[model samples]
Target: MKKLEDSAKRGRPDIVHFALMEALSTPLFLGNKMRVYVHTINDRIIAISDNLRIPKSYFRFEGLMMNLFRDRSVKSDEGTVLMELADGTFTDLLGSIGAGKVIGLSTAGVRSTAEKVAGISRDVENCAFVVGGFPRGHFAQSTTRLLGPVYSISNVGLEAHVVIARLVYECEKLLQEGVDHEGDKERGKIGA
Candidate 1:
């Protein structure tokens, strides 16, 4: 909450907007399998998935988000709107999503080897890979408790956009190879 308040005070809500855009624009999301839940600073959870479109311009995105935050709803010609806003904490939102595992990305967490990280998308039928929306600082204690395993993609701290892009890219690659939780070896084998 302090991180979010700091960003807002600094007039840098664009950071959060771009983080969301990075997640939604990924091939994994484009394939219509992943969902995004944003726990805002004001204690509201904004759930967006499927049929979502983000503005290409940062300022435009900022404007849209500002309006949505004010109005709590905004419709688009593309039929994309703020899906739903629920009153809750981050844990409540996670519980509602019911992902099998919630992996949090943070520099403070253990460094994950490539093989271990590569299996993330296939390890569970439903998973939520959470990245902090605020510019800096760690997740709240309650939220951290809900995370299954916190992993760091890089030795040094990474920007949210970079982390999200790399993680989603890896997940998409594995998913494209037909790797799924059911362990269908035949599906991942090319020309089988």
Candidate 2:
């Protein structure tokens, strides 16, 4: 058997599973402002439903992924596509979304705080953040070609789950702030 470290093994689907869970649990997601797209090592993309209940158990999540690959999608009880395989390279997904700004998170990127990086969501149309799904190594050239801004949020390398959680938290906070700001504005108009 070829013994590769767990992270180095077969693109590490578990890492992607955990990262998706992190992002899915955020307020940014609950508020319906976030969408998830996964680009596979084999040049396919997976689009996750905003309301899909991601399995917490690694074994279950692995099974779900296998089923998705086999059937090309999973549907809700109502037959809505909860997850599906989509055509395209990572670049094609970007073009289809028309993301005004695309930022990639990497330890190799320019040092920046989560606050500044998360600000990409403000005053932007379809802002997208690229968090690596794989545990080790950097994004492939196909992905990097469309990754516009690259930011580093840590002094040391961190796991994909940690990065996804922290970034989603920051983005969620910004979304809340916008809501608060709008409410305050409406109150001022009423008082005027």
Candidate 3:
């Protein structure tokens, strides 16, 4: 994990676009690198994660409508926010960001195409996917419109990279521990 952080820092990560015009037909997006984009309709927030490793159980797109109504409640319309999960789960909260009292909703799920699936490759290590270029106030609509076409680009390339990075870090740690355990076992055998 430490080495990965160093590697990522040493090699500046690149930003890739997940355009809907091309994304709708494909299952993946930009090579193994991670990418984040806002929906055209409600660009209130941005979604990012290891698009592929994300189990369907953790994020679902099919039942989002019903779950939105059930699990979340408006704590304060003035500064209320709701967070939704892929598996029909959500939370409510409050906050203000100077633009006015606003609510935030969060969720994870699959990208809607196969091109996006291909986008989930094993290229980069760890990178941040940022959403930019939109004027203020029109973010939500832009995101909604983007999401409107494709069902969901569930584990896109950017997310795939994130998953790979995490897995590589964990695997490296486990390998080191395995080596230590083997040394201990050998030492015990010699003592016996």
Candidate 4:
């Protein structure tokens, strides 16, 4: 593993990484983990990762945030709105297997999808520990270093199998493409 620089400024940065409640049985934190994916007024997604050691207030906040999304309490232009989804909810639907704590905010005024992805990338730049690119329910249990948004996962229960299968196929295809490209380049080269 490469050394990741610390993004936390002084007071342990609001975002943290810790094991999820669901990972107790499994070797990894999966689905059972929960976190707050706060989207600030600036259009940033911030994942707050608090564990058993963290204050209960953090969990309260997590619960409240999840409720907001569940009840559709999202108010437009609320100037720093925070959104959340329980890890269990994700697992119930998308089968989220991990989580992390960090916020991905957009400086743009809710304009384009490109802007959103850019904001996510910017968050990754500020924090290098980000892996996979999406807020993962399982990864949240690992470290306090802010991570990236996890890749998209299907929410439908049985549909997850399709997503998983597609991901595997893509990974295999990419690996094959990489190997073929390398071989094509090397095959033409004459070594002394």
Name the best candidate (by lDDT).
Answer: 2
Worst 10 residues of 3 by lDDT: 88-97
Q: Sorted on lDDT, highest at the top, how do the candidates line up?
A: 2, 1, 4, 3
| TM-score of candidate 3 to 2 decimals | 0.19
The lDDT values for all models are 0.75, 0.84, 0.30, 0.32
Candidate that scores best on TM-score:
2
Who is ahead in lDDT, 1 or 3?
Answer: 1
Q: Write the per-residue lDDT of candidate 3 for residues 21-110, one digit (tens) a residue.
A: 122222233333223322212113323322322213323422432344465322224444333222210111111111121212112333
lDDT (0-100) at residue 88 of candidate 1? 92
RMSD of each candidate relative to the true structure: 4.0, 2.7, 17.9, 18.2
lDDT of 2: 0.84
TM-score of each: 0.81, 0.90, 0.19, 0.24
Q: Model 2, which residues run further than 4 Å from truth?
A: 1-9, 189-192
**Which residue pairs collide in model 1, if any?**
none
Measured with C-alpha atoms, the lDDT of residue 130 in candidate 1 is: 82
